[model samples]
Target chain A: MSGPAYTPTDEELAHLQKLSSEFEPEVTGPLVGERQSSSAITTEYANADPVYRVKTAALPSKYSHYRTCRGDGHCGWRAIAFTYFEALLRLGDRNRFLEEETRLRSMGNLLNSIGFQEHLYEDFADECFDLLRKTESLVSAGNDERAAAELLASFNDVGVSMAIITYFKLLTSAWIQTHPNDFAPFLDLGQDIRQYCSTQIEPSVCEIDHVGMSALAEVLVKQAGFALEVLYLDRSAGEEINTYRFDPVSNDGLPLHNPPTLRLLYRPGHYDILYKMEDVQQPAIPQAPLHVALADYADEFVPMPTSRGMSDVMSLIPGMYPTGLGQNWPSVSYDYNPSPIPQPQMAAVPTYTSVPVPTTSQEYVNTAHHNVPLESPVGMSLNPPMTIERGGPFRPSMYELEPGFQSNHSQSLPFQTSIFRNSHYNTAHFLNPDFQPEEWSPDSEYVTGSRSRHKSASQ
Target chain B: MSSSRSQTPTKRLLNELQTYQSDPNDALVELGPVSDNELTHWTAVMKGVPGTAYEGGRWKLDIRIPSNYPNAPPEVKFVTRICHPNVNFKTGEICLDLLKTSWSPAYTITTTLTSIQQLLTSAEPDSPLNVDIAQLFRLGDFVGAEALIRYYTESERWEGRQSV
Candidate 1:
């Protein structure tokens, strides 16, 4: 069973002949000026051996099934030993397979019920059938030694590979080594089967590949069918016919094979002979952990009420809490005493202090504290805590004022005109671009956030 | 195991030339059926396997290649009635890798003819080739499949010559 006895067609021989001729003409380098053709790659290949030589040897009575049996040597002890070795290797893991099967069923993954187990049975049966075919041929040739205990050992190899799913590659490789031209074709089929299997099934260290399924799936169905077709055209075994067709690239099995996938080929609730032959060792993933009396952490996670422990927090910002700002960090007004209006607090801690209030309008505190002016809380400054004033003057330069209050406060506070003359303010560009007459007027109208509205109204 | 060959796609098809001298006494390997042909162009037939819904059913296929003989594989299609994942039932295009990607110089028209024959034999109703037949096959009434296969395989024999 190591290799199939094939009779190559005449067309196959001509293909090889064409290959030899294609490379022969350009083999040697020309003496001087011979124009070289672009297809001289074949010329480089000329020195190599001409391939596709058919080996004609009569195996002893052992190969009587194939008409190619020929014997020109001594006793066939070597062939007997090789055959026995193959048998022992094939069936070596039967005990392990049975043990594992029981283990998988105990865990409750019903692999024993699917078509996979039948596949295994089929592999074993096929091995037995092939060995029988070979043994019968040997017995017919009168080589009883080939039919002895040693001759059956070759099946051991088939058994091990079948259990782990390496049978197809081993068979393919044996075919390829003798027929090197078939290497490309073998690899192509191998890879196609691999992708197809790898698609539907996960990669396992020991699982037979998907190609085995492609080959075995059909075989199982046939043996299981046990019936023939009507209006049959013909039946023959001599022709080299491949009854299975699969795609290599586009025929990739479902893409979830390598990913985290659990393909229940069949639903739970059925178990039978077919399931026993399939791969039973699957990575077990449980639905939920068993309920043991473990300590519950829920009681420890109860948060302590720290805000209730504080006594001064309520007095610091006492106010009517704003009804609706719809913000997580909304802030209340800076007014110390309770106001008639329920204040909406700020969304976040202020980045800068509030602008200073004007001497006239009390509504202009510099929330965005800038270094521009000083307007101490009207004699009651001690009641509210504020930015500790930096040493300087009462003018806008002395007190820290926010830029928001710049327009109104700048007009009220006198500029440090003397400090400007001494410093870089002496530069001509730094001088007021529009030098309007500086006038003091209480007549300044109050217009908060609507100077344009007033002007447009007037217009 | 012995699967890949168990199922038989029922359906007989012969190209324009059925006179290739078939030896009836010799066991013949199953191959695809003829769907269409001329003097050189030819189609093949294969029957679906039993126990499956496509059992007793026939499938048609198209097989044509250049005169290069076995140097390149022929393009084979499941033309008659296909209701599996690997074939398009309506257009009769197939998705088997041996046809397109895995084709080698050694392959012949005969090999693909049989492989597709087995494919149609074991029709996976879960993976359908035709949207309509796939639906019908899904309900598990494989009898419909057998009827459809007969229609496609037999009706085409008349349509083929009439259309030409």
Candidate 2:
């Protein structure tokens, strides 16, 4: 059957006009934008039809607010793609951010393996990557708000927005082929997977079905570590859209708190962003999981193996490993050697005093490759030669070293510096510019030692 | 396609134009906007394949890209006469899946024209726009089909010059 007749009568047109006038402006730009409180929807339906009344009444508690999209056939894809990029921006961590960029670039291989010609989809992928790189550079320059504004602008820009949407379609198509077993059973028309993708999924204006949504969720969850929650709002006999969460991973496998999970609202033919109204008023992001909310690589705090890795040897011989130096630990010495420390003498050395080793930036670079110099007494003892008492609070003069530390690293490893120059703790500590140099050193040393001790014990 | 029409045709058409210019296809096909200033209306001239019954034939097609463009496939009609199972003899309408429900934004004008060229070489008799021509091709009557196709092309060439 060809379904209903194509013609729309005068009565039907009038009905459509009346219905549209009841709502605000129809979405005309990006898939989703302009967030409004749940009250906006609910209040409009207060004296209206039973269907909208029921739908809006259920929205408040579950979904505090909604961001409407353009309602174009590509709304589902646009909604999800925009949210994905927004989530990455919120993450603020350069390492994970760059890691995601590399992963996204590699997804094109999946498109190639599925017999898709490069010309059809390469430009879209290139455009998407270009925006990501541009946003990353802006973010690295410490213009976070500007980076965010630029991202929003790109979503509305004609060329970049559609390219990103097309890229999403290609991603879904590739996903269908690589994991046919997962989606084949769900195909309703007895259509071959490729035929279904080309006909229903690849084309613009084709609304997402269960298979499309699941395939997208699978790729996102597995490749990008994103956990998505979709709430379906429809004409069913319910007060609200049914909520479905797609985690597919336990907390143990993810970063500290699993990047702030993305929430979206799916109304039969379209998708929109959902927000917890309560989260908006809070101080931007303190309650948010640090891994996603802050941009600094959590590598500084991530504990190393106590027995096998160099961190283990560094733990045993404290003076050799530059602990509490923050991101300044030369990547070569710490990252180069993963094998366990073989020498018994090195392993037997208990933790040494936390002493401030003042060295020129050149000295740090010179000693980066030589482990022998690190073990020498010249490296252990410094200019003032102050000995930090063990098992008690040891505060090294952080205030005095802060100026030198900043200049030293930026000069030695210019390219390695990130927008987040210091670890979160250092940023908070340094906020108090009046923190006396005498008191700051010993206290921070004790805190650093206790933290390392805690890490070793946990391991 | 109509209710949720997107505003992407002109931009997409410009992109396709750039691509065609940067990497011109083999001499078999040529396509561009009907007028330099009007991007929505395009014209394509494609050469028939060498080893086929339609060999040495050149076909002109009027390509109208709706304001909605890629979202709704371009409307293609043969301006030159051709005898094929899947192409309408009366209205010059095409019966190709890429121009119908299988249409994807991924398909450019070049790809669509290429598909039409392929149709000339190999027509699917199962779903034909012209039933009688489809039956002739289906019965494997190459001699009869070739004679009719040649007659149509010859007359089309004669009319083509007169109109010009």
Candidate 3:
């Protein structure tokens, strides 16, 4: 967006490319496009991920237990690496780092509690130490009086990779350790946040697997936070990753039986989540409705992209996709299934006022039964009225309501069928006056929303 | 652990697991073990509900029950190539809440099976497990709809045919 588009020089691109995970294609060829003075950028690894500040509830959330979700039974495993890359960006936001550290500690605690043995994670932890120390050194030097900063910058690429790799190792190792019996079954399971594997495995085994996953998720959040820190240093962090999403990681890159397959990144303040499916090379940026731009900004950082591919991009440009959403670096908290409530099947579908209704004239059971409801020069208006639908080129505006027929319309959000649940009778507001029963019934008030209100009020 | 124990899922099913079985008396549907030795695993045949496109169709499922019995619910996945909103694209990972966190202890294997049958009968393409089906339904492609119906109703599905 700054001036004419500028392509990085070959040497610079190569240098940046080295930071990427093996899977992310390196931009090393000649610069096809002319370049201009782009914004001064952070070293690729420094801005590899955006730093998130923790935003937790004052009290613990009932569903507060976050998991990395190693599906040992069905063998669907996801590894979360909380990487703190403190090399380039001297993060002025102290609160962000602290929140992340707290999260890391919590993650460590989560792993420990779930009967996971730490021995399995030693490989990952060992590799991460050197990277973190290097990151610290780079941050200490900065644009300093000496060549120390440059030296640290040189080491950042290898160092960040080590940190990320080791962190993944520990995450997967610990997850597997917790799920020993189920571990072998998950050897094929791709590791990453947001991958669902369907294995008709046993319940006890699944519960144990979930606990291990929770532990892994904790670490991943922290690893993501490190990338976020880099983003905080320079807005250029936004430049590296294009809005087009791709897969998260490769199996070899992040260890323990699988790669990070799923990546869900929220635009800052939880506005939208970009779900990156593994194997999908590039995904277009989800265009938000114009109204999305008008929504007030909350001090929230949504989930960042945590797939292997996104992190690979972060390796090159830093503060791009996955890097922007650092784990443990909290912002506004959100729900995993940020999915809107399911539209319940009540007696009446929520009838919105403005959703064009087919005038009674055009109502027909089938396409052949279509009878245009054109008024035959009926009552004259006080003022000369503008022509409504003079059978112009437009086909019939679909507003027909066939009994039991679902309207063929696209909604901005998912509607919840649970709204039709009579089960929520415990609450007075949700309960119907006539059926004040204690039991949760499927036939309840149409989940209270504006559309439902419109349908009831019109009656 | 006893020799007298009916380890045969079909045998135990007809006796001890009677309440948990789908409607076995109806010729349209069948319930028994997919394997001889595995008592926890069962197979089911669901006749496509009438009035829908799949009226004559049949769907097959491989159900694996947990040892915890009634304390937790069993796992049910479609083995046949039936098209529906709640099932996954590549694998049949159903998106029903009852199978996941929304599961209640009171829900029996029979109830869950019935729930799945209902899902098959009334396919809600809006809240879809497979994005493809959702897209097709959204585009109003009823031809794709009938094709899905043919796949389910075919006799091969009843014999536990697997399709890629």
* Stretch of 10 with least lDDT, candidate 2 chain A: A359-368
TM-score of chain B of 2: 0.85
The worst-scoring run of ten residues by lDDT in candidate 1 chain B lies at B4-13
Q: lDDT by residue for model 1 over A74-109, one digit each (tens)?
A: 001112222222222222323322332233223222
- C-alpha RMSD by candidate, in order: 32.0, 19.1, 32.5
Ranking by TM-score: 2, 3, 1
Which lDDT tens digits does candidate 3 get at residues B55-159?
Answer: 766667778876543334578887766667678745767767567644433344555777777776667788787777677788899789667655645643555
Q: CA lDDT of each candidate?
A: 0.31, 0.62, 0.37
Ten residues in sequence with the least summed lDDT for candidate 3 chain A: A55-64
In terms of TM-score, which candidate is stronger, 1 or 2? 2
Query: In model 2, what lDDT does residue B26 have?
Result: 64
| Ranking of models by DockQ | 2, 1, 3
TM-score of each: 0.23, 0.58, 0.25
Best by TM-score: 2
Cα deviation at A288, candidate 3, in Å, is 69
In candidate 1, what are the lDDT values of residues B1-164, reduced to their tens digit? 22221111111113212322352211112332333324235555455565654554554556665443222346666566555655785687876656654543222355456566666555565645566766767777668766776565454432333247
> A154-200 in candidate 3: lDDT tens per residue?
22333333333334434444444555555444544664321221221
True contacts kept of each: 0.00, 0.31, 0.00
